[model samples]
Structure formats: C-alpha cells, structure tokens
Target: MTKNITTTDFSAVKAADKAQSYLFDNFCELLTRVFMALEEEEWATQAAWDIAFGPSVSDADAAWRLVAFQAETVTAVQPLSVDDLLLHRMAGLMSRAVSATGIDALETVRSRAMHCIAQAPMATAAAVRDMAKEALSTIDQMLEHALVCDGDDMSVRALPLAA
Candidate 1:
C-alpha cells in the first residue's frame, strides 16, 4: 500500500518555496525600479554614473566584488574604456543578482545605447530612439520573466489546496 504524506510535510515545502519566491520577487522589483530610473530622458548621463557608482552596497569594495563575479559575460563585448568598463561591471553585478542571460543581453543593448548617445549630435533622432527601444525591450523582458517565475512558484505552493 502507498503511504500518504502528512500535511506538515507539504506545509514545510510550501514555506520554503514561498520564501524563495519572495526573495526573487523583491530582486526583480528592485531591478525594474533601477532600470526605469536610469531610462528617464533628463537623467541619461547621470543615470549611467549612478549605475556605475550607486549606493546599492556598503562600500566600493563590496560593489567591486559583485561586479567581478559577473565580469566574464560583460567583458565579451567591444573593448571598453575605463569608464565604460566600470559601467559594464555595474551592469554585470545587477544582472547576476537578477537574470544573468537577460541582463547580459541588456548590457549589450546598453553598450549600443551609450554608443548612440555619444553620437547623438551627429546622428538622426530616429537612431537614438531605436537604441533606447532596444534597452527598454530587454528591461521589459526581464521584468516579465521575474513576474512569471514568482507566479509559478506561488501556484505550486497553492496546488494542493486548490485541488
């Protein structure tokens, strides 16, 4: 005869899943907020600076550690200047904390965005908008994936009750 599992066992699993879900949700929300803040029209340059040196961590050393962890994927793009490398480092840290693949794609788009910004004075307005669109699309996808994962986890925990 098959032995039935106790409600207590299921409850424990549910609790663990809920905690993981909460952590992922919070991380995703923070990423979205930062992305939105950086995307504002007036704060473009400042946003880049903030992304590189924001007060997200306790100190520069901590920030550097986070960046170093994800450096490999980010450094695969074009050779970056010191300043550009710093920004890429920040992007790497942010991506590792959220979704690595999505964030890596975002960083590539961001690099292109910076290129467009640098050339804005000589380029057509349409070109600038296109670059911005690419960055925003990546951010949108990241947020969507985070939300879906959160929902799926919560649903898994609720399945027994629903049944």
Candidate 2:
C-alpha cells in the first residue's frame, strides 16, 4: 500500500509546503521507476543504466525487492536491423514523453506508428508491429487525457496541460 505524509501542523502555509513536498517525492519516485524499467529492456544502453542507478538507488540488478526482470543474456552482436531501431525509437518517444510534444508532433508519431502497424504481415516482425501498436495505443490514451481534437481536420488544442 502507498503511504502518505503524516503531519500535525494545521497552518495553511505549512500544509501547502507539506503537500508540495509529498508531490515532489511522488514525482521523483515515478520518474525513477520509468528509468529503471528502461534499464531492464532488451535495448537498454549505458545512458539507461546511468539514469536508473545514478540516483539514490546506486546498485541495481535484474531484481529490486519483489520486482524482477527476466534476464536477457544475448551478448552476440548481430548485423544492423532497422526494425529494432524503429521499434526502440517509437517506444522511447512514447514512454519518455515528459512534456507536451505539441499537437503536430504527436500526430506525426501517431501516423508513423499506425503505418508501421498496418504494413503487410510480411513486412516487419510480428513482435515489433505488436509492440508498436501497444506504444501507439498508450500514446492515444495520453492524448485523450491532454488533448481535444476537432474531428474535421484533426486539429488539436491542449487542455491547459497536465500537472
């Protein structure tokens, strides 16, 4: 279960300060979890490792408390693969969208993800296509939360941004 701040002070200013502190801590924990999950991915890089372990959690393995990641031990280097690149890029764009990507950029990503999903059953591997579809679906959920679009020309307006 999640634990919240405990306080006895009832002053308005003190309560606001406590609330801000709680929110900041919650935000950091969420952000840290995101990076740690990235560090567990098949395409995880040095950057991901640094981001995940560079904070208070200095030593991260495949397991953290009850959370465990399936070990991916493929060290063999293979030839270049565009599908891998495209899939990772799309995942990165979807998962690490911390700020408003603006309506236009989000639309472009949606279009690209859709095209990748629509390619013939012969094009990219089914796994890549499936992951792309999942990422696009997640982005659509995010758009539903933050953007309102006109059905006519797909024009969008931000909803005062999410906090």
Give the TM-score (vs. native) of candidate 2. Answer: 0.37
Model 2: per-residue Cα lDDT over 1-163, one tens digit each: 9999897756966765565444333323433443454344213333454355543342332322112111111111121244444454554454333234466665665676677566524556565565556556655754553453324232222321221
Give the per-residue lDDT digits (tens) of candidate 1, residues 1-163: 9999865458866766565444333333434444443333114233443345543422322333433333333434432233333333334434443333343454554565456445444333353244334434544544454344346532222111001
- Model 2 spans with C-alpha error above 4 angstroms: 1-79, 95-98, 119-123, 148-163
> In terms of lDDT, which candidate is strongest?
2
In model 1, the worst 10-residue window by lDDT is 154-163
Clashes of each: 0, 0
- TM-score for each prediction? 0.26, 0.37
Q: What's every prediction's RMSD, in angstroms?
A: 20.8, 22.2
Q: Which residue ranges in model 1 land beyond 4 Å of their true spot?
A: 1-7, 40-163
